[model samples]
Target: MADLSINFAGIKAPNPFWLASAPPTDKAYNVIRAFEAGWGGVVWKTLGEDPAPVNVSSRYSAHYGKNREVMGFNNIELITDRSLEINLREITQVKKDWPDRAMIVSMMYPCEEESWAKVLPLVEATGADAIELNFGCPHGMPERGMGAAVGQVPEYVEMVTRWCKKYCSLPVIVKLTPNITDVRLPARAALNGGADAVSLINTINSITSLDLDNMVARPIVGGRSTHGGYCGSAVKPIALNMVAEIARDPATHGLPISGIGGISNWRDAAEFIALGSGSVQVCTAAMLHGFRIVEQMKDGLSRWMDEKGYASIEDFRGKAVANTTDWKYLDMNYQVIAQIDQDKCIQCGRCYIACEDTSHQSISQLIADNGARKYEVIKEECVGCNLCEITCPVEHCITMVPQASDKPYMNWTQDPRNPRAVAA
Candidate 1:
């Protein structure tokens, strides 16, 4: 079997799939059950100072697809509502029992040297493998000058990370918020503060949808709602780009990453790993599908690794980072044409309508030799936009095939079409 084990910043785990610091890992009960279900690690729910914040009755909202499947999920839920002492006790015992599994504590505190100084040791006393600075909860916590409030400011992220480093002996992994304009700034700040690794992206601030009937946002409690953190499969593209940005940035290069965001399966986990995440974390997937979801992630990743001839996670980690680049560097002279297979077409006309009305008129509606309605690509008019390919309903029915380039290599800097071309 391919080795799924990862030693991220000295925190060892049987595999890279860990439960993110969410409700799924809130208490010993949930954490224990997750471990039994085969999750390699758990970043215990964000534990703040005593007197945890109260939660609203309806703390969640969701965006659904046509089939009523959740496309994205939003939550106004706060951190651990249990007492600090209770959390500490449970963490200590759980670590002792599951010594093989990685247990990292996620913490948030008031923006004070004393506040951080007070909590670091108490959490450290639990013998937890590591500590994650939870500066990325985007909702209720930010209002109190914690969570994303602390994360949005680079200086504060560096300062707080420094406090943890000074007061605690374990490795510090800074959990970052995605609400910032430039994610690299906070990532660089964490590195500057001597953080061992970084986990992202916390959550994006979003109001999923509003109830037209009541004219209120979703998860309305007593006729009110506030913007909550949005997450799930919809955020994967955003998260992937952010992770790739941090991974490829010169300043934070080689910095350990624990990727989190819309990671519902092994392929998602692999993509994060390929983009340079040392480990992957999960929350929404588990919350929706239960802890049992980790089983498929583990099995699928391991099987994929075996097929790819990768002996271990490290073998293919960061492999895709090299291929990620700015648009200016892309091959401008390259071209491809869309090919539609008539046999696979169900005569939906989705591609034809989409290409005709909105996109390039590359697809033409016509009759095939079999006397059936058909859609054909107008190769002359096709710009290789792939819009029709994406709009098509049948899988693989429309494909973009590379055509021989008749033009020599030329870029925007050299092209006559450029408004401001440099003197050759």
Candidate 2:
């Protein structure tokens, strides 16, 4: 009922949900279907030079739950395998037909200004709204001195971003790799080099498993396997933390963010917005489900927004940022302890075992007045570490109860461990 329109880096999208550059946006055909399914936009799959060849079939493997929840997505796929000429032609046609949809092109190549200068004009010529430099692809291309190689170096991020700014008239969105010690460094570099926006986090380097039986892992070649970049719901926490870090960094304070990695539903999208992402991007979710999933996401997000009385997308975007603070600034008095409901407990002493072995020994098992084995939280020793809550099988069975007033402080407010902490 309310308007879902948003302007990302001066480009308009019907909503804040955009399909990330992946197989879904590998070509114009897929993007057209995605837009028809209610997706706001698509970042056309990463394109490279005139001729780029990637691996054959079986380049992808996924980890999923029985209920169909996509836990993780792994890819050895390289940049666009299509020729540059054809990709440009298709991009031109797609933008012409879907003028209202945001069309941001993702591209990667050698870390050369000439290479970028040569490519930018052609991409802009295709009438794309913006350009997202693909500096974060962790597999296949890194050995060629592209992708994550360029992304890992802050100086290279700055240099490459500056090249795009110099030649590419359209807004430049620098895609960041999460393989660094702290994401803030490269984020700062992108902003410093005049990037209009930044998108993250690219897949983390991971090796899912080893086939001990066959002595050859998946996506294997020559009886050995190399690590691939990982995506999907499993990486959501890592992506969120990195997004928050970039958003709060003073160096990249006002830069627009295109949030990527592990977005399946409207709730995840909303969380990214709260952490200061202007637009949310999806890839593996759509791959697992059909394009129709966008319908649910769009409707659900709209309904939730209406319920929250947000007249528009920007109304609630980043509202939670004001509440997020450095460790030293948090309130020290707030505290909560795990409270397990007897009815919800399955009589499994997992909570007690976990608490005793890895956490505070606050759980006590004793015979109840009714002569039943019962596990109770020792009010005196319970530190509210939350290990029990996490390992619980049932949801909402184990919850944390806030501490009483006049107790010892619970938070790390005025963190004595921080070097910047004011010496008392």
Candidate 3:
């Protein structure tokens, strides 16, 4: 079996799967349970000053699919409502008990250096492996000039990260907010401030749905609703892109990354690792399923790695970064056409309908002598957009076959059609 262990920015874990800081890792009971279920680490839910923050009633809402599956999760909740003293005490005890598992504490405080200065020592004394600066909470705490408010400003990100680095001996992981226009700015700021690693993407600012009858957004509170942090499988693409951006950017390249947002399975975790995440974090998946899901994640990842002849996580980590390039660098001469397999096709006209109605008219409908409807791709008109393949219900029914080409590889930067093409 391939080794799943990782030493992510000095915080070692038996496996790369760690529970993100959320409701699941809010307390010692939860952290202990998660460790028992095979999770390699836990970023204890964000802690703050002594009083803690008051959470609102009806803290959660969900965006569901047709089958009533949660596609996205929304929460208007604040940081840990429990007192800081209680939290620190619990963390100290938990870390003492679970010495092998990674014990990372997530914290958010006012932008002031004093606030961070005051809390860093207390948390450091808890024996936690590292401290994650939670600069990414999208809703409640941002109103108090913390969370996303601080994350949105690059200057604040650099300043606070510096404070943590200055005041604490533990590794500093800057948790970045997705609410910003450009995620790389904050990532670069974290690097500039001497952060050991960066974790992302934090929840996005979103209102999942509305209560139509009550005339408010959800999760409703006293018939009124407010925007909340949105996360889950729906945000995976956004998170992957942001991670890639940071990994590929010259300014932030090689900065350790703990990939977060919408990771549910081993494949998702593997994708993040391939894109340069040293470790991957989970939250919504555990909430939807349970801690035991980490078992499946570890098993699947290990089996796949073994099949691919990988001996360890580092062997494949960041393997995809080089291929993840700008659109301008993509090959213009390469082409593939969608091919429909008649044997695999369930005679579902979804591909034909999607292509003919919305996309290019690249598929033709045919009526055979037996009165059976058949759909075939129009080789001439197909742009190889894969719309037909995407809409097809059956897996492997439509495959894009690359055409053999003798032409030299050419990109937009070298194409004659581009006015700004580099001089030959």
Candidate 4:
């Protein structure tokens, strides 16, 4: 059997699946239940300085797809609302009971050495495996000069992380915010400050819906709403690209990454590992489905590892990172054309309509030998854009087929089309 165990930034766990710091890991009750459900670890919900902020009612909003599936979720909730003393006591007991599982405490404070220095010892007493600097909460906390307010500034990221490293003895994982234009800047800053690892992304700044009738946004409390952190399935692509960017960057290469955002299944976790995540974190999925989801995540990953002839998670981890590259590195000489399978076609006309009306119009309506109206790709006009394939109803009915290329290798950087190429 393939081993699911992982040693992420020196914190060992039975598996790489850890509950992200959210409602799911907000307290001892939730963390204990998650452990019973087979999760490898939990990052205890973010703890802040004493006098925790009050939360408002109607704190959540969601974006739904055509079938009413949750595309994205948004929330304006603050960090752990419980007292710091109570939270530390619970974390201490939980860590003592679950010795084998990784317990990481997520913390935030004002950007001052005195504030961070004071809290580190209290949390360190919990015997938790690590501490994650919570710099990515994008809602209420930012307004108070905490959370994303600290994260958006690279200098503050480095300065605060340095304070944590200075005062805290445990491994420090910097949780990054994705609202910035370039995620790598903060990632590199974390590494510069002696962080043991990094996790991304906290959440995107988003408004999930609008109540046009009331002239307000969603999650309207007393006829008012504010932009909250957006998460869930819709943010997966954005999260994946950011992870890859940090993993592949020359300055931050070899930094341990705890991948979060939109991971719901074994495949999702596997993709994160392949893209160089040392471990994976989950929140929105657990919120939607329940703690039992980890069982399937563990079992499915093990099954896949067995089929792939792998011995452990490390054997396949970071395997896909090599293939991700810049657009300029792509083969300019490569060519492909879309092909339509006649037998599998249901004549949905979706492909034809999509191509003709909005796309390149590379697909044409024609009469087949059997006198049936057929949609076929116009070979000469097809740009291999795959828009038709994306809009097609039948899976595998339309595929991009690679054409044989006799031309030599060429790239835009050095090609004649490049106006910025330097003289060699």
Candidate 5:
């Protein structure tokens, strides 16, 4: 197997897969089991200061599919409920006992610099590999001036990050909130504050649905409730886009990224790495499947790397970034005309109905060699929009063929947002 190890901003992990800061990393027991199961590291669950806050029961609920597969995980749980002294002791013992694994302390305190400042020295005393500022928790702590609320404002992001950088000698990783409009602002804020790397995304705020029987939304809070952070495979695409935005942005370019959200297997891990993530993080998947799942991820990634002739994680990182671009940079001059495979068509006019009502009226229905409804494309009328192709549910029924220099792409070129082809 090829090497799966990664050196993330001077913190090395045996592999790019690390358990995110969640239930999976809540304590030394769980973390050690995860390490034994092959996870390269663990970001300990977010810990708060002394006088630990009490948490409500039923603080988490999951969204699932027909087969009861969890598509998303929602939680109103706040930072660690364990007292600060006990958490610190455990962190110290865990690090001293297991020196090879990356043990990062996830921390959140009041927004004030003093609140964060007081916690830094205690955390560093644990000999932790790094510190992840827990700025992404979306549910219970916003009003306290922590979590997503602070994360959304770039100023707070910079302010708090600076606080950590000043007081902590270990590398500081700013865990970003996905609740913002544009991801770069917080990323830039972290970088501006001298963060060594950034890990994303914290969680997306979401309201799953209501529990009508209780006359409230779930998971019930004091007999009522509000939205919580949504996570798992459902959020993967959004997470990938945010990660890519940060990875490719010149303002934050070359920043070490810890890709989080919806990573279930090696394929998901590889995709994040290819998009320029130095390491990948997972929580929901491990919560559902347990730490043993990491064995599959490590084995699969190693085998695939050997097959692809990639000797290390760095070998293929950002390999796909060049192919991603803004809409205007797309090859609009290149076009595709719809084509139908006669043998593959099951005489379904679903394509014709779709084209006539919703798309370019290009395909004309006619009875061909056999007494079957055959659809032929009128090339001149074909706009290469791929609507017919998309409408056809049957595989290989409709195909789009490239048109060379047939027409100037004019659909979006006329928009005010199109700067390149403006009135020239």
Candidate 6:
């Protein structure tokens, strides 16, 4: 079996699957339940100064797929509504009870250094392993100069991160917001402020749906609604791209990352690790499915690592970063065409319709003598766009087959068609 343990920025955990700071980690009861379910750790929900903010009822909304499966989740809920003293007492007890598990406290404070200076030591006194600056809450907190309000500004990100490092003895992990124009700017800023590691991406600002009858957006509050922080499976692609950018960035390269956003399964966790994440965080998945899902995640990752002959997470971490490159660097001479497997075809014309109507006219539909329908790929016209492959209803019904070519490897930067092609 492969060892799944990780020492993420010096905070040790039994595995990389940490429950992100959300409703699931809001209280000691939930955290203990998650630990019993085999989760490696938890970032205790975001805490603030005394007089916790009061959250409204109907704080959640969901985006559903054709089958009514939740594609994403939106929440206007703010940080922990419990008083700071109560949260701290629970954190102390939980850490003492579960000494082996990572206990990271997530916090959001006023921009003033005095505010952080006052609260940092109180949190540290809990014997927690680390502190995560909750700079990415996209909804309620930002209205009060916390969350994304601070995260969107790189200078504020650096300033607050510096304050945490200055006052707190535990490792500081800066949680970054995806709402920014350039995520790398804030990531580099975190590095400059002496952050031990960074985690991302926090929920996107979104409105999942609307009640047309009432003319209000989802999670309606008295016939009115406000946008909430969006997260879940739909945000995975966006999150992956941002993680890759930070992993390969020259300025912040090698900075530890705790990947977040839309990670639903073990494969999602593995993908994040391959792209340079030291560990992975989860919130939406745990909310959608219960905590027991971590069992499958752990089993699948361990089996896969054993199959790949990896002794530990570090062996394969960031292995894919070297191959992730700019579009201009991709080989332009590579060629592949779609091939339809007749035996596996269910005679579904989805591929044909999708290609003929919206994409290149590369799939040909034929009528057999007996009045049966058949679909075939027109190789000469196929652009290898994979539209037909994607639309095919059956698995492996259409595969992109690479063709033999004598041409040398060429990228857009060296091609003659480019306006700034280099001379060979």
> What residue runs in model 6 are displaced by over 4 Å at the alpha carbon?
none
- Model 3 Cα lDDT, one tens digit per residue, 6-118: 99999999999999999999999999999999999999999998687888789899999989999999988888989999999999999999898999999999988998898
Q: lDDT tens string, model 6, 1-424?
A: 8999999999999999999999999999999999999999999999997799998888999999999999999999999999999999999999999999999999999999999999999999999999999999988889889999999999999999999999998999999999999999999999999999999999999999989887899998877899999999999999999999999999999999999989999999999999999999999999989999999999999999999999999999999999999999999999999999999999979999999999989989999899899999998999999988888879998999999999999999999999999975
Q: Of the pair 1 and 3, which is ahead by TM-score?
A: 3
Window of ten residues with lowest summed lDDT in model 4: 415-424
Global CA lDDT of candidate 2, please? 0.88
Consecutive 10-residue window with the lowest summed lDDT within model 2: 407-416
**Residue 198 in model 2: lDDT:** 97
* Model 6 pairs in collision: none
In the range 1-424, model 4's lDDT, one tens digit per residue, is 9999999999999999999999899999999999999999999999998898789988999999999888899988889999999999999999999999999999989998999889899999989999999999999898889899998899999999999999989999999999999999999999999999999989999999998988999898999999999999899999999999999999999999999989989999999999999999999999989999999999999999999998999998889999999998777888989999999998888988988998888999987899778899999999888998998888999999999989877777766778985442
User: In model 1, how many backbone clashes occur?
Assistant: 0
Judged by lDDT, which candidate is best?
A: 6
Worst 10 residues of 1 by lDDT: 415-424
Quantify all predictions' global Cα lDDT against the true fold: 0.93, 0.88, 0.94, 0.93, 0.88, 0.95
Question: Can you give the TM-score per candidate against the true fold?
Answer: 0.97, 0.93, 0.99, 0.97, 0.89, 0.99
Compute the lDDT of residue 184 as modeled in candidate 5. Answer: 96
Give the distance in Å from residue 325's predicted Cα in candidate 4 to where it truly belongs: 1.1
lDDT score of residue 169 within candidate 2? 88
Q: Tens digits of per-residue lDDT for model 5 on 16-130?
A: 8899999788888998888888889999999986788778887887788879888888888878888888888988998898888888889888888788778899899999999
- In terms of lDDT, which candidate is stronger, 1 or 2? 1
Cα lDDT of candidate 1 equals 0.93
Each prediction's RMSD over C-alphas, in Å, is 1.6, 2.4, 0.9, 1.5, 3.2, 0.9
- TM-score: the better of candidates 5 and 6: 6
Candidate 3 global CA lDDT score: 0.94
Clashing pairs in 3: none
